[model samples]
Target: MAPDDQPAPPLRRRGARMRSAVLAATVDVLAEHGLAGTTVGAVARAAGVHETSVYRGWRTRENLILEALAEQLDAAVPLPDTGRVRDDLVTYFGALARLLATPQGEALLRLSAERDDTLPDHRLAYWSDRLDRGAVMVARAVERGELPPDTDPGLVIEALAGPLFTRALISGAPLDATLAPRLVDLVLGGASAPKPGA
Candidate 1:
């Protein structure tokens, strides 16, 4: 076939690139205008796509925001397996506390706070998944004899995060760097420790 007569290869849309664009735009809109300010049209503009394109991919603004924020949350907290329960809990919560202490992390919390009835159930599911990942990691440690088998993973996870969120959202106190790991140790170690009277 003559070079000029060769048919052009069918153009393929890059799924990864498209997803990256969407995630990037989500973060941009979040950082720029927060949750209330974020809209399909604004995110589309930021991502260099039409509003309909975003809607086609995510179906709604709430869905798009949830996916984007979920991506960041996933990156923020990885499943911990450091071979020691105390070490693992410390590593996990410490990282989370650090993230919450940052400007982007604070903004992310604010975005979550702005959620209304229009928000989809998937957003709640997304957070639930993140919580489950942490729970599973701790559960494994309990199963391994590193932590007491009776130790409640859900309670442990809550203890690790509850105070941080409460202070940030309610009391307005700063997240003290020294307190996070110590709190993790108290819960995990306390549960596994033998009773003094026993």
Candidate 2:
């Protein structure tokens, strides 16, 4: 599927500016109050626009928030087809490590992890969408006989990304691009299923 955060085809100048302002407010609100408190009214206030503008434009608070998340995720980590799973993973993870160390990335991670049943499902769906898109890499590796057929792509992603998140959010360890290859090595060494007839 095409990336949901693809740039708008085009829009009138006023409309485009409004949308950009709203998205900027969305991130600000998420950083300040998180998911539960971020609403169309709040974002509109922060953006200095009418609530109707935000509501009419985004339809729901969830969409506005997710637009911000999707934009940042797309900018921070791009999935490239390098014809080799390990190389692709290294590139992806290295970029992620760098992003996670940034202020916006850290705020996004904290807000994304918030658990609020009253909120729209977009917060969690953001991750589901990410995994869905990322699975293509693992699937490609499987086709190349790098990973076993039964190996779970989502789990593999977790194995690779989870540690980076931990180091960034929990452990407060310094992040380095070099960690990407080491992470790929660890994930691959333990990722694939048992060899045939071992």
Candidate 3:
């Protein structure tokens, strides 16, 4: 048994490494090429893995792109906990605005808007999960009394995000640095304002 005859490492280790590489490469490719241009061959080449390996693991290009985009979005927009709801909202939405202004982020927004019968449910699920995760900030604010108990976290998040999406995906408006604070103030203003009866 010569040292050269030693078998390769186990499939688990190789698979894990390949998965990481593929996901990272997929994000880069998506950023560079957008959804229409991204392909398994491009991602595999970027990842230094065989196209068959990517297909075997992800089963489809849509799945691979969705997973990569989801991972990137989660990392890029984290919920801020500054102990003050206003500051938290400003920081969180500010990061989101910045991300949405980038080429990669714009590509993701366009990808989400595309009507793909194969990914309709999956895309909706992804956005629903993101809204839920973002709503935690408002939920915490309510628990801390920064916002009224009646505040709808999901609605608050949607209100803050809707305009940004429109600007990025529809009107092609600029996502400036000042926009997040302004939006946070507008949404939180109504949320924190005293009720008519109160």
- Predicted structure with the largest TM-score when compared to the true one: 3
Which lDDT values do the candidates have, in the order given? 0.76, 0.80, 0.87
For residues 94-181, what per-residue lDDT tens digits would candidate 3 score against the true structure?
9999999998888887888889787788899999999898899999999999888999999999999999999999998899999988
Estimate the TM-score of every prediction: 0.82, 0.76, 0.86
Better of 2 and 3 by TM-score: 3
Q: Candidate 3: how large is its RMSD?
A: 5.5
Q: RMSD in Å for candidate 1, one decimal?
A: 6.1
Candidate 2's C-alpha runs over 4 A off are 1-13, 32-42, 45-48, 190-198
RMSD of each: 6.1, 8.1, 5.5
lDDT of 1 at 15: 63
Candidate 3 clashing pairs, residues 3+ apart or interchain: none
Which is the better candidate, 1 or 3, if ranked by TM-score? 3
Best lDDT among the predictions, by candidate number: 3
Query: What's model 3's TM-score?
Result: 0.86
What digit string (tens of lDDT, one per residue) describes model 2 on residues 1-198? 479976443233248788887888888887788777888888888887888777788887767878988887787799978988888889888888888887778888877776766444877777878877777888888888888889788888888888888987789887887788877876887447553334
